[model samples]
Target chain A: MTIHTKTLKQLSQGLQTGEYSSQELTQAYLNRIQQHSTLNSFITVTETQAIAAAKQADALLAAGNAPLLTGIPMAHKDIFCTQGIKTSCGSKMLDNFIAPYNATVVDKFNTAGMISLGKLNMDEFAMGSSNETSFYGSALNPWADSTVPGGSSGGSAAAVAARLIPAATGTDTGGSIRQPAAFCGITGLKPTYGRVSRYGMIAYASSLDQGGPMAQTAEDAALMLQAMAGFDAKDSTSAQQDVPDYSANLNDSLKGLKIGLPKEFFDEGLNSEMATTIETAINEYKKMGAEIVEVSMPHLKLAIPAYYVIAPAECSANLQRMDGVRFGHRCTDPEDLNDLYIRSRGEGFGTEVKRRILVGTYALSAGYYDAYYIKAQKIRRLISEDFAKALETVDVIMGPVTPTPAFGIGEKTADPIEMYLADIYTIAINLAGLPAMSVPAGFIDNKPVGLQIIGNYFAEAKLLNVAHQYQQVTNWHQQTPKGFE
Target chain B: MSLTTDDVNKIAYLARLGINTEDTESYTADLSNMLNLVAQMSSVDTDNVAPMAHPLDTIQRLRPDQVTESNQRDNFQAIAPQVEEGLYLVPKVLD
Candidate 1:
């Protein structure tokens, strides 16, 4: 098998057995990344740093006490701050901003002896559903050249799907990771809020943003999460709860697992073919002794409207720090401080980002605060309650990740609302702050579909176990795109 | 409710974002469409529901008033768009 096609586990074993040196592995990935540069999956390629780190990892391996991820190649979403690297988050505002310190997640990965290839591309400030909002340009779906790979984790998903890198980190706010992972035909987990530290991940919406792993399989995702999931004193909102070993239950039997099917998820907006694809995947679970339960989450419909308000409102507050004076972009010949703030931000951000910021400003402004922001928060509570009530009756929830397969590049760009609707099936989980994953289920019109499996708070292990079992029964997750294979 | 160009301009001002005159019309339409989407929230009555600020609704953990991080002013200011002599330089506020 080609080195690029090897799963994280197989690569770890290869390293242990001296089948291939870390330097050789890192070089292979770097070569693939350069060869597939048309995918636009990376913003920065740290050839020197990756090789240097791999050499260090080789020394550790020779000493005989390295972690499973040691010497294994991976990339981080540009959203995470990597000290001395340009952590742009796919925005012109930070195009010149090199991080002064590592984000907690980056520090953790480095500590695990993982060699980072470089920074992956993402939507500007993690705003758009399609990665077209990225200042670095859109990352093409490896499945098809004309379609989007999904965003703000678009680069991360595309890179992993193309096997340019084994895995990459992605942050989700309103289904960024899972949606992109679905579109790209990979396994991605968005852990329950606070499960991963967000100290150095560029803040989009502080309350909703979460960092997680995107890989080719549930087992690989579990391995990445094992290194990523932990509490950090730096992120105040990070959960103090101990993280369970995600790999412990990967092979666990799915017998008697109760999977909830939310009635709202199969509404008229759902693509009929996509529905059939998800049904087939669920049928496979049923054959494995899992039971399907029909549940109602009426409030699921409000997730997008509520998310649009809360996420933007939090983002407006979080992003206020990007003014010209201290860091990020600055306008030349500014007349005054206000001019610097206005013109700098105007020159820095993209259209979608500006739209969200304006919407947030309006929602929080006088007279509209109660009418918009507060109302959305209250609806958020209802959405969370819906999940809480449903989880009481089922071990996990299953549904289609996106309404349809990957849309063409410019398909939904003109209509922001249409793009927002793409995330309808997945946003409720973030509102409820629950752990969820997207596992490749089947294909439609030559593109892939994902079966979203959502679990209660801090149930990442259970989600991984369920997904891993499904992967074992089927080869959907193992299928590579046409040219990539 | 739909936002007018006037409303969009006001919002852009409040956000400290300079919206070009040419883009204001589009921004108005887009922001209005988004607000219309957000208008759906009014259909649900959350009269007794408490606002959820955090997903888990957990209170923030307060750390003791101790300096955990050493000063890295130089390291941080190195990326500043305009900085000199350990101070971030901006237009004079009191001239």
Candidate 2:
């Protein structure tokens, strides 16, 4: 087997044993990245810096007492600010803006001795579900060239799935990380909100945005989260709770574990074949001594509407910083300050972003604030309460990440509302600020589907344990695309 | 509720985002469709439920009243579109 196909843990062992040098591994991955450029997974390759960093990691390894992740290569989603590197967040607004500092997540990974391959492509301002909104075009799915790789973290998932890099970082706000990870057939964990510091990570929705790890297995995800999860004083909303050792309980038994299957997720909207695949995966859990219980979350259907209002409202406020004054894209020869702000933003933002901003503006306008914004907040409480009540009876919840597998590139882009419904099953977890994961279950017509595992607040360790146990008995997560493999 | 072109224009102005005359009709239709989707929230009765601005419902953390950031105006202003003498230059705001 090629070194690229090995899991992160195995690669770590290889590096520790001197079977392969960090420089060699980094070069191999870089070559793979260049070979697979058709996937359009990366916005910048950072070749020279990556090589230099790998050499430094090699020196640390030679000197002894190096971290387990010392020589492993990975990449970051462009949303995370890396000093001296372009942090576009897949928008024309920030296309020319170079971040002056590193996001806390990037610094943590660098401190762990991991070599960063480069920045991956993503949706414009992390807004779209298909990644077509990116200023840099769509990132095609590795499974089928014609299909999308899911979004805002589309490039992260595609790169990891193709083995261009063993893993990469991703952020989830209304299923950006998990949904793409699902469509690409990988394991992605969205840590409980505030579990990871959001200090320099670009904001889409303040209350719901959380960064986590995407990898080929839950074990690798646990390893990545070990380095990524923690509180930072820089991020006011960061959790003060101590981050537990994520890798410690990865092997814990799932025997007698209560897994709740929300009945609302199985409605007619779900494709029947995909539902069968999910059921089969659940039956495997039943075999492992996990007791399945059907739970009702009646308010779950309202998550899409609630999220549309709340996320856009928060986005409208957060994105006001993009005025041409400080940095980012600016229009030439503006008539006045108002023209600069309007023309610059109008030129910088894409259609989806404009649509969202307009909706948010209307919703927060006078006479409509109480009707839309406040009403969504109240519905948000109900959604959170539903999850809280469900967790009272079950240890975790399981459902399909997307209605079906990856769809064609232009399939749902025509109707924005139709595209929004793609996240119906995954958005509520974010609303509740709970930890969840998308583990590859199986395939439908050569396309991949993910089985989502949801856990209560700060229950990431439990979620990882559940997903790891299933991955042990199934090879779905290990399956790679035909050409990529 | 369907939004008229005037509503779209008003919203664009409120957002400080320019919408081309040609794209106005499409933006109006798209924004109206999104609002129709958002209108579904009215079906849920949330009279007694409290509004949840934050998921964890934790109060904002307060820090000591001290300057934690050092002066890095040069590094920050290096990426500005137009700057002069440590100041960001913009179009004339005064007549």
Candidate 3:
């Protein structure tokens, strides 16, 4: 009766049939969180509050009325503001900050009757590719204790991998969710821009930030997303569209499905181990009656450059709220009005955050605006056009989620370029505003690797079908991390 | 100096960041290195390019302007560094 081994589908059915009360399920997760606390996957565990919510969920079930995610224990990335819970965004600035209102995603989860297992740790302000940027400290991969989980969604991915939570929420600005999901060997998806509301989710880059689901399997990821996606007036950018049944057509056959493998993803920098794993997954799809086409996304090389400029530029503007006079951390010394601003942020944000802020500010500066920020935007359009053209000829794109499997803690923290390179394959989807996913493919060095599946904008159902169909044929997603009984 | 030490100080202040003037020299050095890294964008020609503000080509979704937020100012400002009558207080600037 280990909580980590069971799927959300099974958990939900059990709850619906009165097999286990929400309180029992919440207690089991609380017990597991205590047991695996050494992983540091969670920054805050909502035991008392979660238990209360679970009691309410159970009551609803008993009353013969329950939501789609009724009584299921789930995890949230710390970036989302939870009413009355600590929402640190992995920075010292908000270390003492408790959100007064639930973020849109959190409110949606509550409405769906999902129990909050805990808040997963992440990079400060969702800035870095590695979780090392977190002010609380790094969240290591569950698969290999020494390796780093790709982040700022690292803690969420690690939580699901370690069996602490069945599924968790993750935000992707660049590759925050998918990269971490790949590194930790789980299922993570970043829906098309505007698909998910961002009002409650802390913004890193307004244009790029998207909140989605991360879980052990694609089906679980859909279940998690079902609770999180929708339109809200609070977030003007949220799409005004009906939420689709992501689990619909999930079990559909993959026969004759057109899969495009962008040539750029298989280039020189790809690790041989990851390359082998991805190729094997592609072949598995072929065996399952799918066609693999070699498509070219020539502007692929420009993604990292465009992302660096665009993400940071947007970040520099979005982060202006953390002034000393306002929210979060404020410096103690008050020599003058200026010192309050400098030392407060200097003391508040992490190194990666400061670096990006500095980089972003410079990019948006008057003289450099046209050269750096403006040009990056143009390149972004071309990248999007490339995807649009490719989609016309294909149903989906397959590639390595990351260039390598998750590396060990402190492995690439010092070398920012190396860490940035890890996001090579996944960043393009975000730049294109397309829905993409990372599904556990195979092992590399006994560590998990993910095969990235990308679909056209608003094509999440197709992407989920691709992952679900592969799961029916392969057992990779079923491979649980060690120390799980 | 692509930007002088004083220029760095001015920009930091303008951005609402407190830059320790004593560290201005070092800040200039760090910014110089970063700018050098970002300088790669200058070489690419972008004369005809339309700057992208969003990844999507869809028209900006607009909602009727009205009161959508509830009276959660107390809930929100409760986390502010200094809150008085629903306003975030700061050091006196009119002196």
Candidate 4:
């Protein structure tokens, strides 16, 4: 039997009926990954572990007892720690380090019998909008080789979009997951701040980092989210809420659902093609009996400014653990204690990582603390309050995921401003700790553009419902890049 | 409100990052450009506004003060460039 856009449901039915076993499915993905290494979508493939897990999944199936995610293959962002796997957050600093334990999220997948494909590549320490900063190099836009797959979850989105694996995990620290999903034409979700566990996730920003699923469809994300989300005593931040059947109302029509379109997201500097695409998506929602209303987020423009401060400040503190003396890449020659510290860090980190560390250290400095770092945090509350107020008026918010479709690989690398601008449309959600998703809306210049749908806290079900309802009518998510096929 | 080359070097040093004094010129230029945008926050009157570092202000209910981390001292020090007994090795600080 051929694998043609198989969902978890289809794959499970096949595995249960003995049409194919977990090992066969794992091998198929391994073969695809080998064939598509040119895409640079994966940093390290956990072939040994994946095969071992597949064998276990097969045994469970034979025993007639299997979990919801049994034998379902998934990929993880490199930022997540996998026991004995090289869990580099796409930076050279930790390039040689192998985690001694699995992250809470990784253990969940393993316990559910989900076969691991490998660790997907990401931006250096989950920074940057394009995947270019990765030490392993950038993931190419499968849709258009000339462009980049948006990042820092670029590899996670690309692998799923390329069908190397049906779905993958991505951590969104200020839109890392959603932006890449938008560029790669897949469904990616950034659940609320505490919706998923972050323990053992090599965190760049403790407060903003959130892990969620990137898959071919909203229902697929829902199924993965079912396994991914819940309270974990291991993670202090993990919510104490029970995991809902995300697929329960996935078929629920969007009738009478109120969606707010923040005027700020559509104002000046918005791309015309992107605007048309989002307008088309919003129009489709209207036809589905959803109400669209204009909303104002006064703090919208403040998000980028606030995020640059808070994310980097937190990143600066989190990365302090990697001093080279503590099991990471070390420099060749060092005179003394000071030399060791300097050379180890300077050589270990990438340009972007250093940049953030510098910025973060600056913000948190004593003299400048109140002037910059503390001020940004005050603005953060306002940003979340803006989302809270908007939610009072609408069930969900819809807008463009990014200002444009996937850009050329090296197009904005030289200009940091251009790179940061791509995330302008998505960063505020992280500040608000709101759940958001990027669904393929349509194409602009033959590259996919995603319609961003954001929901209030704990609104994962509604976002998935809306995305699922939209996917039933539109085939944008179904289209694949030609040459990859 | 903008930072100078001296400011960049000072911040880098304070952050415990060793920087080549010569490279500070270029680092200064790039940092100045980036920091200039960030300087906007200075204009906002946050004098009385309480700093909100996290989305939710709940004091983290950390799992009891017990040591949750495993005793991976041996495993952790396995790949250390320099290790002695249970401690990570570093050069002598004082002469």
Model 4 Cα lDDT, one tens digit per residue, A180-288: 9999999999998899999988888998899999999998899889888999888877788888889999989788999999999998779997898899999999999
How far does residue B13 in candidate 4 sit from its true spot (Å)?
1.4
Q: What is the C-alpha lDDT of each candidate?
A: 0.94, 0.95, 0.85, 0.87
Which candidate wins on DockQ? 2
Please give the lDDT score at residue A43 for candidate 2. 93
lDDT of 2 at A26: 99
Off by over 4 Å in 4: B20-23, B42-48, B65-70
Pairs in clash, predicted candidate 3: A147-A408, A148-A407, A342-B18
DockQ scores of all models, one per candidate: 0.90, 0.91, 0.52, 0.67
Model 1 segments beyond 4 Å from truth?
none
Candidate 2 per-residue lDDT over residues A160-181, each given as its tens digit:
9999999999999999999999
What lDDT is reached at residue A178 by model 4? Answer: 94
Complex DockQ, candidate 2: 0.91
Task: Report the lDDT tens digits of candidate 3 across residue range A87-107.
Answer: 999999899888888898998
TM-score of chain A of 4: 0.98
Lowest summed-lDDT stretch of 10 residues in model 1 chain A? A242-251
Model 1, residue A462: distance off in Å is 0.5
The 10-residue segment with the lowest total lDDT in model 3 chain A: A413-422
- Could you tell which candidate, 1 or 4, scores higher by lDDT? 1
